[model samples]
Target: MKWMPFSFICLLALGGCQAVPSSLPYADPPPSQACYFPSAASSTLTASVDVLTEWGFSLDASDTRLGLLSASRERELHGASDLYASPHFSSRTSLSVFGGMGIGGRSHLGVGLGGGFGQLPIEVERVSLLWDNHHVRVSRDIRRFDQYGSLRTGRSASTDDFCARFQRALDANTATGDSPS
Candidate 1:
């Protein structure tokens, strides 16, 4: 016999379960829930981008312009709503809060998270993109080994030099904006 009762129960179980949506819709993430950003996100993220650029990426002056464009778009996507909600969002843009949208803020926040943890004091994502997706410092020893290998092969600069160069790039960016991005 085919265990009809068991099959019937299985069928009911399968049919009764609701499909999980691919994404949870934003119904105003509960007001009680505050944003908990991690502390190392900025430094770690800055370090990562600095490293990427130090290795091979070409982050020229035009790259800065692109960063401005991207940061504009990013703000539009992630923090647009937050920005638009505030008339004092910047020293300029006196009445920009009226231009609010939700996507920009979300994009900015998501990108920011990728560089490190989440508690970065500056805009690490924008900095990374502007720096051509490299970082200045590295936490893992193997990464240093990778750089050393490149040097051994005569295809890379010294690790300390790379870090210093990356540091300069990051510093340049930090000085440009009102906030250290």
Candidate 2:
């Protein structure tokens, strides 16, 4: 009859277990920005490249005929000090030293160290510009990578600030007949 308690406890534990919900919805994508200019697509593309370069993005691909441009920028997101302050490093170290004296004495000393040259967080921002005739649309995608080079998080959006800056720059360049520098 003593075993009945153990069986009931096991059953209770099993009943408490729940399957992870797999139907969780993902977040919505960020909004894109579009602007219209009276200038031709080719000129707009050239000016866009110049402005993007000023923003620290390197042109990855461009097709003037198709009015498409792609650029990306990468930057480090964290340093060694940030890594050391993270829980991934702080909570993993363990040290144990035990000594006992008796007929059956046992002495044990152990050191468990965790953490390595990992934990480099990087942020990559990619921008896509598409233009046709006098209308230009710009979208940005941002992704954060963990130390292992795996994507930690990502979002796609074109903020108003970016669109405003791009429009202002393009207007100035196109109006002044200033070629991309």
Candidate 3:
């Protein structure tokens, strides 16, 4: 029959519309680093606070008894100047008006207005340290926020390089006999 060829073509087209998988491969967590110290937990925590402060992070909270220390640092990814330079920073205005007569001779009018403003992004990095008498574990987290202070994205378990650097700093601090008050 003449319709057989057309049916075959339609089947071929439908078969070509297979759905492609959009799933992404799983990502492994970043490596963690631990530093060992010979000093008391309190002393190690104090030195950690000092090092973190030097790195621009302010101590948020700590409990030497529990060997827990938390610090955070915030920096603006876009400054005021950058915000001013953005295209969205310029003042804009939009208006639309429409008038129509219906079948019953009724008149209708509609108007729409819209505007937007630009906002900068801020980055905040946080670090946490836990330690015993001679062992310390450090972890870092990073988050991004909009100018309105709403978090956009965040990640935990930063790379090992940061912990390594902290370890070196702690080593130098202890080696120099910097007593913790």
Candidate 4:
């Protein structure tokens, strides 16, 4: 009978729980086309790198001979309310003293401290990129966990900003290398 309240509370907590939201539906990549600089693979790779760097991504992997490249960017989300519990803000203090002299004296004291609310610190965004023969594929993944520890994944739309810059860079490279015959 004494444990009935505890059991009921546990049941209620479980009943209120739900799974984290699922990721967005996958979308097929656009049709592949010949690169702007068909004969200049080096220039194409350089342009891809430049565009990726301009967009705040760093090179993670690359294979010049194979014409493969990968890049990623990471950032933390800020400005969220602190309405959860955290051990970082919870603390305890204790002091004890005992002495014997002309008269016996003894004293003991203890103290505990904790904050009412804490920040979850669980919002982050990551972007990954892959460069193939004549195309660059980009994927943005967002990860966040709630106070209840439920993790969620989100999808970000394709970024045409980099693509536009890449095309321009390729055009410039090809135009400059060709001289009057």
**Per-prediction TM-score to the true structure, in the order listed:** 0.19, 0.61, 0.60, 0.42
User: lDDT per residue, candidate 2, 22-74, as tens digits?
Assistant: 89754246553343334554478777888889889999999877889999999
Q: Which stretches of candidate 4 lie over 4 Å from their true place?
A: 1-41, 81-151, 159-162, 165-181
Candidate 1 C-alpha lDDT tens digits along 51-113: 455554433322333322111101112332332232333322233232333565454222111
Report the C-alpha lDDT of model 4 over 1-181, residue by residue, as the tens digit: 9999999999999988967768875634431232222333436567666766876778888887766667766553343324333444431222333333453386545455444233343654554445555554545445665443556544453446544455675556546545455
**Candidate with the larger lDDT of 3 and 4:** 3
Candidate number with the higher lDDT (1 or 2): 2
Question: What are the lDDT figures for the candidates, one per model?
Answer: 0.32, 0.71, 0.69, 0.53
Which structure among the candidates has the greatest lDDT?
2
**Weakest 10 consecutive residues, lDDT, candidate 2?**
90-99
lDDT of 3: 0.69
2 against 3, candidate with superior lDDT:
2
How many clashes does the backbone of model 1 have? 28
Residue 18 Cα positional deviation in candidate 1, in Å, after optimal superposition: 56
TM-score (C-alpha) between model 2 and the true structure = 0.61
lDDT of 4: 0.53
What's the count of clashing pairs in each model shown?
28, 0, 0, 0
lDDT of 1: 0.32
